[model samples]
Target: MALLARRAARRSAASTKAAAPPAAVAVELSIPAHFRCPISLDLMRDPVTAPTGITYDRESIEAWLDTGRAAVCPVTHAPLRHEDLVPNHAIRRVIQDWCVANRSRGVERIPTPKIPLTPVQASELLFDLAESRDTAAAIARVRALARDSERNRRCLVSVGAGRVLASALASLAADGETPAAALEDVLAALVCMTPLDDEAARILATPTSLGSLVAIAENGSLAGRLNAVLVIKEIVSCIQLTGNVVEELVDALAKVIKAPICPQATKAAMVATYHLASSSERAAAHAAGAGLVPVLVESLVGADKSAAEKALAVLDAVLASEEGRTSARAHALTVPVLVKKMFRVSDLATELAVSAMWRLGRGAKESEEGEATKCLVEALRVGAFQKLLLLLQVGCRDATKEKTTELLKMLNKHKGVGECVDAMDFRGINRLS
Candidate 1:
């Protein structure tokens, strides 16, 4: 009887014992497991659910879809399409609220993600642009969507919006001049939707393409001209423009450099010029004839570093041929300009500048007359000799060093050997000492 009474008393004492303090019991709250992306394993900012019931940050999933894997969900390997990745706004809201609640823990609130333009919507927009029924609204919508996100751009490109936009740019021929505002809108969207597909490249290769782009580059608004030049750079990269078309393209690019709307415009113009001149000697000749050299030289006066480099690159390509060299030699600023570009700009600028000068030397050397000696004297007169020596002093790549040495010897030959060497002040120049 005594043991049974003690056992009952112990059971009641254990049941009446106080629980742990709530202050100490409650620790930090963990984020919900479903709030994280499967691919990134991080909290989802823009949670989007795939067709297979897996959620990911929109950027992560879009990348998975774009890299030739659009047919399957990354997590489940189920069939999917680019059009079916639905945004989980409810989950996004929850994730954001969680972030807000944990503000003291360095957790930042995720921004509301942009709604991506679906491929279906992009297709409809393309149709609207093509039919010219809701042209203005369609153009504005396309521009907005293209500027929104890379995924939207991919969607636009997939539905052939790039080609249609290029067509809109060239439509001045068939439908008369479209409104300038409308054209500029189309240009902005086209600029955003780049790396045009093979079909778009073929469309840009047509004769009308060059004409339309040139008109815009020469006569459009500053923004329009900038966009036009950017598109021209892309278009010229793929197509083989020639004959009168090359001349026209050169003229437009030269005009841009001569009176640039912006540095971007000038640089893009230089890139387009390099593309045309670098491949074909005929194109180089055409560029020279269209008066591009002087324009590039003049643009270099107060230009920034990158612009200077591009200008020199264009000059190097243009001066590769005999006709281009002839035009440059006639220009008063050619040698002085080349000399000034040496060592003051980037290594690429120096290399391009030296290459152009060497081309002039070679061209002058191969002539029937004694122009090589005249060229050497003229280069010396422009102070190119010491720059070449300074080139050697600073140490250069093997090729540039070899050319500089040859040019030095040529200067020695023409200026009476001792006279050329006597001009050197070897204070800082150690390599030639």
Candidate 2:
């Protein structure tokens, strides 16, 4: 009876006591009213000077001034003095706790996802852009891509994404943007590329296949059009990418080299062809087919020294090739142009001309040799020897000096050594050295 009575009393006590109020959940506020109170808005009282020699409000002065320049000091209306101010370190700690508590409400600044494009979609866009028929739409799309900051930002995040790169390259090609503008972007994407995507190859090949890049180099009026140097460099890279696009490159270069239209463009084209000649055999064949030798020979007499110099360089490069030998013979060229160019001596023109002449003179038939040799001797006899000897004296280390030596030796062997020697005396060649 005593145990049951005790159990009942315990049950009554548990039921009679109301459940204690649920434990209060603590809520923190970040900016307290005191800290946030602007000194400019509050009245200053009992101002005391700190080490900075400025008086401020005593009670809330230091607290309000804690955030440097966030509020004016209590006494001064100017911006709160930064040096005299100190941060409320405890506020940051409280903020950390508050952030931890409200993590679900925190805004995460995550990067936006890019509009994912596929290889097929990228290729289709490129195909449309590359078509000559849709040049306007293609250009508009490219301009839009350039202006679309959001899309570009997302693209930057997905730099190595093959589809994005293909689309970007296609856009650049379609717009015909200047090389300087497009080159850096393309190179950046290319460095990150994992494998050359099929879309990338197709888009890249589009321009090379079109053949107008060379034409533009040949005669583009656009302000920053791709020049000959850049064109050849790109074609070389394209050759590496496309494998045996040399034929296409050759045809384009030939077209530019042979285009008789714009002299500057022609000069630029020849310069490009000279660089290309440094690499491929097809350049030699195509240059010969396009009648490059005769054209350059004509440019020698042109008024523009720049064009003439470029022409001479190409001629020199051309004569070094086996096809050049055939071209030289088939044309039955003369040495008068060579003689005139040798006297140029402006830059490398004289040296190139002399070298080209030597190469062309290689293993000439007896009759051809007689004709050239006779003309060369006549030039010497007519007081050309003095200038040749003077050229030898003035640090002529290239083909000019060597050719002079050969010509002097040849004159000696023409059984007219003594007569030529006497003529040299009259022309002051004997006194030059």
Candidate 3:
């Protein structure tokens, strides 16, 4: 009832101001000096009281600390640990009230900010999740808090929510009878707490946790599968993955691609696959053996520019291994797909596709001379030779330009017996680089 009365009074005040006398409206109103953050010189929405006894907008101060140049107070230059910054509720209310009073002057109301989660609150929420008590509500509450503000996310992370969630998932992996829907909810909340600390990464890197995530990536709902792939990507980035773990990651990615979820999931899997293949030769060979090259080859045919670029980059890295080359060489679509992707998607994609074609054209084994002849013949059949010449006639990156020239030379050297190295169609051409 008191809250209702306060809102009614706020409305009355605004109506009064909106109907004020002309002279009263003529007087220019200004924000109080104290209401402006010293760092931003702007009205403070989320005013936090720093240890220096000065208040600044939350985002401004957080940005100051993220610079990592110094941890000292931005105002006082005194040593400051940001964890002590408290929400200045009193100031926030005043600022909001003032905005309401001046609404006729185009003042916009700042909705009340959500109360940040105290460490105790965060711990209790994690406890509920960990203890399996009303688990869905707990996951929803945790996710709601995380989505509330950067401050809430920081508080959750500070209290070790990452490790707790990872441990919970690890337990799910160990105990098989649990419904996978719970895993989905827990993972849904867990995905937002990214850049997980070393301990959390280590925990999720365990075999059981990875196995559960792989299972989700392969068979869970699209949202759950995307979150799983994302978590797997983060874990791979954070820790030193073993051969078996790398293989598992590759297999998950391959499965996701084969199933064809949303673009986000495919891109995540591609990024992870690229990282795994580039990490080591053995991993690259494993990726090829898992049929990544053929899958990428098929996917690249009509892919959008970004996906094509990423797929080509992964294909390039995978082709560095003999296994990748052999696998791609064995594919009927490899040469044609490489040719189709050339000079079309992006500079990077064009460069990678050209490199992949060269690798396939010059197979590692002398006994594969027939493969090389077929590769060149297929390139001619698909007009790859013409595309290479045009790539030079137009412009490209310096390194890509070099690769294009090398490919042109190879084509020239292996031309049909009578074809005098066909001069580039430089009709309106200026000096070539």
Candidate 4:
């Protein structure tokens, strides 16, 4: 009995302690005003002085410059004469020292920031990398330079390193003895050169370089494939592609989309396809025949609004051809997916979806009345008629409404669609009747 009483007392005390609220720690740590960045209002990691003589975090200031959001300093509001940003090494050291001194307050010491390479320095590095006997080391150095800072990346492009990187990739492809690591680095460098200028893009658009990129897209690692796609996208966007180049891009992008290594890479591949397909009708037919319909349908089913919009646009372009229409009709989910997206995504997406349906329906109408009637019945069975009528009632673009009217009239002409039409409460149907 005595032991039992003691055990019960201990349990009650333990329960009380466990249920009690935790006490707040009262350590107050204040950051010195000089240590904070004027823009971010946080301790600076890499302080840099702009032309306005105001010190700000390097990333914040660079972002401001890159975005063209402001031509003046955030702190002084003085117009900048030039966009020169010099590193404030002295302030950085002071901030690091303060962090170290306040270590007990959970402060972390900031590492020394790497100095961004100048245009001349970047050119020299690229030259050495291209001429290096040690290919592996050269590749590693190139990747490190790319990962260093955005400023360095800009420097590389300013000094023509983009062309050098393209040449290296082309040479490697020609050698056929290039290591995977080296190839990946070259691809990464090219991608890092964002918004490639016309000169750099033309350099990468060469046949040998493009073939290498296609090879990488087809068989490289996930990162390599994504980089290749991104580089191709930039190249195609900046330069006018020739007939052969468009064919090559279509083939590579089609393969990448079929087994997309990643979601982002798939989106890149799709955008590239859209760019190429917009160039010619023959390219659209080629992309459609290369198994793009099913992939696009799959993407629409799972994509977010932006991705779905792009996918619909591509579908709209490609569906203009008979081969594209046939491929879309052959895909089991295409019609249902289009109907589902009619009013669910964006206005642009809606327009594109309705247009694709109009094209497909028109194609069916051209293939004998019986075949057209059968296709109309199938569309009605998938709730397409209800969605189209609702689209008309809710208001769409004038062009889209017109297309919707045509599609609805075509469907209502089918004798079997009477039941599908009656199921809708949309008053817009009276016009069709």
Candidate 5:
């Protein structure tokens, strides 16, 4: 009886081991070979066929091309003649069917991939939109197209659709017509024109077109405002602005930043401000006067690293002129905010913050009993001297250290606060002494 029980136990143990391999095998069998991308070795979400007769995910293949690797088929190693990647619809349908059949196994259906817009199709769509009397339908269609794949966006730009849309916007503005729906659609399409070419940017930068965008920024829907700001940022990056245009741009950016729109729009506004201010001191002063300094100081209250860095950079640019320095000094939180950011953010932010402080300090020393002295007093009250001592002791970039040394000397001269520096117990202060 004991021998029989041991034999039965051995048989059960062998049977349990045999059952374990089938679960993994079943999982392996569920994924069809054709569904996998050769490049990524995963189930393709958006498969396209290369000219070499092998299918791959569109994004994966685009990244492959972007890397400038050998122009050979990854699978068959055949020399690729052309880079055209056609959608493999048959395989996609098969994969969908397989997913449906496996629904009981918790397999989710892959969404149908959006068809990319071709240049011809984009041109025709632009013409239809231009002539369409149904404004709502046109807006919906434009939004859908803009939200589609990246390839469609590139095609829209290549087919001159962006220029046509800008011209339409210009005409609308010239006639003093502001159909909210149509304007939103046009602005959204312009945003989709990533890498807006010089000509497209020039068209959008015109006074009429730019004013339309500003109007959208002021009164359009949140989506419209976000897209407008983004398009403006892209346009500013590609072109140079001067005189009234720069002033208008800065004003629009300030309004958007002050509004309760989305974070993306705010970030876009901040970036646009930085770009415009960096272009020239005139633009920087204009931006500062447009309530940019106070807005940036408030933005730093709870800003992330990237946003804080950008804000500091814009502040630095704005502080280059006497007017900009005056504007910054007038803001109650300017010195404390910059002092707070000195070492708390990135090294780049530290450098920019230090430079801005140096400028403000230099301006204060040159003053008799004016706003500059007030700014200096504000700095001291905010513990700017103590923070500067700590920054020197903790050690920073070489340039930052040098600027900190200069700022300390200037502050010491004004306040005669040599005891403040003497009270700090940092090693770097000893080096400074």
Candidate 6:
């Protein structure tokens, strides 16, 4: 209310101000002592001529009208107003001269500053020594880079020469001669490993390398968990290597999911498991044996929105698998949660929820016994159809045209969709009853 009143007052005052004729030529005016307001310390807005043949600003005049004694200056607390500011022309000239002196464009405006070394560049220095022909020189450089913190130096060296060393060691493994430096090279790389997919897979394949990577993951480093995900994508069948890698991956993922620092890594692990299950029979059995699906379902119903999203994504991936479609037959309660989340989640999550629900609905339709079909239909009616048509008229303008069209068709085929569809017609508009 106060804000509205002030705006009204300003507009009223501005309308009454008289306009002056345009100047025939450009004329510069120096700031005058009488033109400045003592209260605001700014050029006065509506100056009035005084009886003493001098012009005084509004604030100075206001102070004099309030009291007959000396008025305090607004800018400086010194006592001086109408009486002290006696139309001084000399002070105005000094201010204009000072302004003119400060006006210029020159070399003093350069803004460049001294640059410092980046950690990446420092890491590069360590790797450069690996290419040197002299072994002693290269090892000396590695030692210097490692310094007192062997982990830090190893991290740099692993990222740099780590791959070349690992490949060389892999070649030596075929010949049955494991050099002492081979394990160290792989360990160094694993400890310093970035979140790259290829490096992670290589590190996990070696038993010694896997132990080192696991240590990093358990130490709250996240590198081990990251490596586990890398290996998951490449496992084709249930060989000796596949079983060991899967066990390690599951163990590493369980540890990661429990940590507060990288729940996303846990999500990644679940997603990789989902993807693997879809492609391999052995993987499906392994994942189910590890109790992955129930854990993922719990996360979907969990409190955290981010974790729920990841869980849902994993579920979505899992549903695409033959095992997932088969498992959905037994879990009747899952459909309701997926339906409820469609509207409750973020925009992307909403789309994912819709997609997952649609797939499950279609999959259930194919079943002869209509497994979970009634519950899914009820969830869609209460969860999606209740609010979805209304949303089509509000935001979400860019929803995929075909998807939206398909949903509309499905809604029309639904039992209670008549009420929602009637709400959009001309006569029924705004009259939901």
- C-alpha lDDT of residue 129 in model 5: 65
Backbone N/Cα/C clashes per model: 0, 0, 0, 0, 0, 0
Tell me the tens digit of each residue's lDDT in model 2 across 288-339: 7667777666556543567767877777777666666456545423345555
- Every candidate's lDDT: 0.77, 0.50, 0.81, 0.78, 0.76, 0.48
TM-score winner between candidates 2 and 3: 3
The list of candidate 2 runs beyond 4 A from truth reads: 1-230, 233-244, 280-282, 329-334, 363-386, 398-400, 410-433
Candidate 5 scores a C-alpha RMSD against the true structure in Å of: 7.6
Question: Candidate 5, which segments miss by more than 4 Å at Cα?
Answer: 1-30, 67-71, 76-83, 111-114, 126-143, 279-282, 330-332, 364-405, 408-433
- Whole-model alpha-carbon lDDT for candidate 2: 0.50
lDDT of 3 by residue, 1-433 (tens): 9999999999999999877763354244666899888987778888999877989988888888878858878878987766778999999999899888887776777888766678898988888888988767877888889988877888888888888888887887788877888888878878879877788889898888888888899889989999999888788777878758788889889888767788988888888888888889888898898888888987886688889988888898898788898888788778777887786677788888888888777676787777676677767666788999988888888877887787777776667721433444433212111
Alpha-carbon deviation at 210 in model 4, angstroms: 2.2
lDDT of 6 by residue, 391-423 (tens): 566556354334544555564566453344333
Kindly give the stretch of ten consecutive residues in candidate 2 with the minimal lDDT sum: 20-29
TM-score of 2: 0.44
lDDT of 3: 0.81
- What clash pairs does model 2 have? none
TM-score of each: 0.71, 0.44, 0.71, 0.81, 0.77, 0.46
Ranking by lDDT: 3, 4, 1, 5, 2, 6
* Model 1 stretches astray by more than 4 angstroms: 1-44, 49-56, 60-86, 99-111, 279-286, 289-291, 298-305, 321-323, 330-351, 364-374, 378-412, 415-433
The parts of candidate 3 lying over 4 Å away from their true place are 1-34, 38-42, 72-80, 103-108, 118-140, 239-251, 278-295, 298-306, 320-351, 376-412, 415-433
Q: What C-alpha lDDT, on a 0 to 100 scale, does residue 372 get in candidate 5?
A: 62
Q: Model 1, range 160-273, lDDT digits (tens) per residue?
A: 898998777667434556666666777788888887766676776667666777788888888988988898888788876767887788888888887768778888899989
Prediction RMSDs, each to the true structure: 13.3, 28.2, 9.9, 7.0, 7.6, 20.9
Question: For this target, which candidate reaches the highest TM-score against the unseen true structure?
Answer: 4
Per-residue lDDT of model 4, residues 1-433, tens digit only: 9999999999998887665432111123567787778877777889998877788988877777678666777777877523477889899999888878876656677899887777777777877877855756665676678778777777777777777777777788777787766788878877777777787787778787788788888788889989999998888788768777688788989988888687788888888888888778888888888888878877787678888998988888888767788888777677678877887789999999899888777774455445445556767866788888888888988898889999999877763754645453434322220
Model 5 global lDDT (CA atoms, 0 to 1): 0.76
Quality of model 1 by C-alpha lDDT: 0.77
Better candidate number, 3 or 4, judged by lDDT: 3
